[model samples]
Target: MKDTDTAEETSPEPKGVNLFGVDPLIIQDHYEIDYRHSYAQDSPFFVGLSKGDLLGSRCTGCQYMYATPRSHCMECGATTTWEKLPLIGRVHTFTVCYYGGESFLKETPFILVLVEFQNVNTLFLSRLKSIAPEEVHIGLPIRPRFTKAPTFRVTDVWFEPMGST
Candidate 1:
């Protein structure tokens, strides 16, 4: 009886993705939630983005380059060295996000593109800009559009067409 009472008194553990202090069990199928989270800025990724520069990491083991600029290489597991990249790339592929789902679901559709930078062995994904959905295609040249004032977040930059490519 004590166990039963204790169980009844305690709420069930929250399931799925809970945004903020929202109780999932009490929430309906569709709801809106506003929340904020902090991201670490100790890496070159955020720092380079803040400065409008494309930084990459090169692996000495396999000589593979990472555009995302990690501390270590994924292949063969070696420490990476940082270098500045050209900051321009071609669109390898992309997805049109008509619906983001759950707490997301943007009102307007947006394009998330996977770009291949010059002399880099890694592919970077970010929001694609200045291109219509109908005009978006593979192999389109893109360049970064940096904010005048950067918050050192990934949102501080986006990619735009590099002149008719």
Candidate 2:
């Protein structure tokens, strides 16, 4: 057999646009990413969201309860088991988004909160409902407001304050 170095030396030219070529790569290209995003919403967490129940994953090794459950644990790489979580939580932190991308621009001046479920190790981000953006505060008691007709999507999850004292 011919030596690899010698073989490569006699090989045909590679079939790609070289960087130093006269016709350089196109600097402006817009790709429309239009396809069904099917994987992220296929988990037990999304199923529970559709059913108006809070579901999570518990790590068997470290006992970490993820509000938005993944199939595996982030810490120990162990398989996780599905667990039910309470809908009620408190606002750990928050922001009032006045503008964002096209989809979010329609919902301007909305309160987005990072919620900490009672006794859970992690916090979850969701939109705060039934509360004005100016009224949101840290440690505000909140509960998830699920759609009545049940849309099987993550955006179906939002929170409402429980009237803090």
Candidate 3:
């Protein structure tokens, strides 16, 4: 949820990549830039993204680990420290977007999801990769895939069905 009149508000064109001689659509630049410069800066999310690790913020005081870093803990209101979490989790929620704001992403129907780690309830919002929409389930296991973006230092977070390899 964002206010319409923010300083960063700008319309962006979609991006595409040559995937094995085929052009694959990407998210719109406006949305991508908004996400990169906004909530991601202060958090260790980018750090993990760069290192190909799924990082989270943990309340050192309460040992509550969150998939994405936050300034403070939701449970205890204490400062959080970054922790690298395992990429394994179960899908908690998901949605298939038929219409992507960006023309690039609009080419293919994509799945957005919230996944929860095993033994821990911490959830991370991400996209499903290389999986069919019909195969996705509320409790399907998944693992992270760090897309190697050579042009950008920060790797992108994508997910695959567990045992996908």
User: Which candidate's TM-score is highest?
Assistant: 2
- Encode model 1's per-residue lDDT on 16-121: one tens digit a residue: 7564766557645866698676544336777777888877788978889987867778988998887877767889999988887553365358889998987888
Q: Which candidate leads in lDDT?
A: 2
Sort by lDDT, best first: what order?
A: 2, 1, 3
- Candidate 1 or 3, higher lDDT? 1
**Model 2 alpha-carbon miss at residue 105, Å:** 2.0
lDDT of 2 by residue, 87-118 (tens): 78999999888887776788887878888998
Native-to-model Cα distance after best TM-score fit, residue 17 in candidate 2, in Å = 29
RMSD of 1: 8.2
TM-score of model 1 (CA atoms): 0.70
Which pairs clash inside model 1?
Answer: none
Using lDDT as the yardstick, the better of models 2 and 3 is 2
Off by over 4 Å in 2: 1-34, 40-42
TM per candidate: 0.70, 0.73, 0.68
Taken over the whole model, the C-alpha lDDT of each candidate is 0.79, 0.80, 0.74
